[model samples]
Target: MDTSEIIGQSIALENVFRILAKVAPTDTTVLVTGESGTGKELLVRALHKNSPRASKPFVPINCGAIPKELLESELFGHEKGAFTHAIRSRAGRFELADGGTVFLDEIGEMDFSLQVKILRFLQEKEFERIGGSRPHKVDVRVIAATNRDLEKEVDKGNFREDLYYRLNVIPIVLPPLRTRGDDVFLLADYFLKKFCDKCMIKNLKISSKARELMRTYSWPGNVRELENFMERMAILCENQEIMPEDLPDKILSAGGVEQDKMPVMPARFEWPRLRDMDDRKMNLKDFLDKIEEQLLLEALHSAGGIKNQAAEILGIKRTTLIEKLKKKQLG
Candidate 1:
């Protein structure tokens, strides 16, 4: 539930954070546009978290997930016997989210008729439930997210232009993972540690070669795909390290780095000179910790997460290894 959980250190993400800081305090309707799985819902949640309505309810409904026939009643509620299934009167998302924030996800998939009601609500802050004559007013902040281009939908007569402009009062675009530079590795590490903690497993680390391959390969499914893949690895990988062989065929094929051609090498024994520290701009503790972490990860990988064997390989006692893991909070 952390507001800063939209993980990325890339400038594109930083720009989004900047915009979020400026706009989240108000009730202006925000339109979040991004490729599918770029974490649009996360962005909307962050917006609500920072908004004055943060203490209020946050209601989300997917326009694409729900059937068209039921979507109207789902959004605007219905009176008793409004439809065959409506045995009693019910409040809709808009009414339920009064004094709060309502997220309309995948708004592009919404039926045109429902779009009219949404548009009216945006204008009047009031709506009538199905089979109800009286108009119900609600003070709610609206946030909508879509992967499609609303301008194109508007031109095609699939979406109302006025609604598009109204909802797009403040626009936020999330960059896909492929374009996020080193953020791929950052997110990968974050997800790895997260899933490891969740499953109560020892720390899982990505091999440098695997990291390189991940960097080069385009993540078509973006952050969501990476998160799922890491969870799968946490449960499925036998070794503490994520190796090239462990990657999906799609990643291996896309990266085009054959494991047979590039086999793993033994750890080198290069002593880090003072010049090395100066070049890397790292202090002594950070430099040593980085080296120690890599060695520990390599040992764990070679021993397949066997603590005793890994400790023996590192020429350290089992207790020492456990202490280091604890210090690093990787346990």
Candidate 2:
């Protein structure tokens, strides 16, 4: 419900914010394009909220949600006798949003015929009901959005070329969530607190291992998927701190299980300065091997001698970890 709520500080989103700051004052036809769940509609609402038309109606029409036959009526009203059903006269999104903005979401899915009608309204600021004769001129600003590549769609002959040019006066592109660093944890914390409050669940912090697992997994569904994942964790996690065991099955085991094509030494030690022994140079591999052995000892001590849990923290396979333990003969 908050108008200015923006998420993530990725370079792409920062660029988007720069555009939003510049365009929020002017009445421009904006085309918000991005993959689904990237917050296109939120940006549209932000535009409306920031614009001079902030007090006026900001209507949002999903071109894909309404039926093809009804979509025309949804965008441009229908006269009582327009179709066989002969429904009563209606006010369309454009008409209802007169003196304001109308957001056409999923505009790429609009039928070719309706595209021309929309283009006409964009051009003349006027339209007629489906079966009415006189044109009703309305001062309406159009902001459109879609998940499809409209330019590519036009090139493929699936979308209209004229409408493409008409609605795309200003364009904003949003990047997916995976590319956004740190924002993941930021949003995760936000959603976790929000859902916990709403659902009356206790607050929780993600365990260190769980945090590592979350950071490594690829979120294909973007922000939406991450929110859902958080909600599930909030509902299921009973303790004050969420742990790797609390995460859903797929995520809990991700990243740590992948086979290591090259074994990198994992070590922790405090020893006499090797810098003083210049000519006594040992093979770097041997130093790394010794380092790995020392680190294993530290991990065992850190884990209270629990190898399985220690292996989980180190992000290595338990068997490989045990082999390392045996090679070094460290308990």
Specify the highest-TM-score model's number.
2
Q: Which ten residues in a row have the lowest lDDT in candidate 2?
A: 253-262
Q: lDDT tens digits, residues 241-289, model 2?
A: 8775566544533333322312453587445466623445866677677
Question: Cα deviation of 244 in candidate 2 (Å)?
Answer: 2.5
**Which parts of model 2 are misplaced by more than 4 Å?**
1-4, 252-331
Local accuracy of candidate 1 as per-residue lDDT tens digits, 1-331: 3456888889988898988998899889999999989999999998999888999999999999999999999999999998788899999999999899999999999999889999999999999999999999999999999999999999999999999999999999999888899999999999999999999999999988788768866787899999999999999998989887687755644442333333365498567799888899999999898678667655765676677998999999999998986575335
Counting clashing residue pairs in each candidate, in order, gives: 0, 1
Once fitted onto the true fold, the runs of candidate 1 whose alpha carbons sit more than 4 angstroms away are 256-331
lDDT of each: 0.86, 0.79
Q: Which residue pairs clash in candidate 1?
A: none
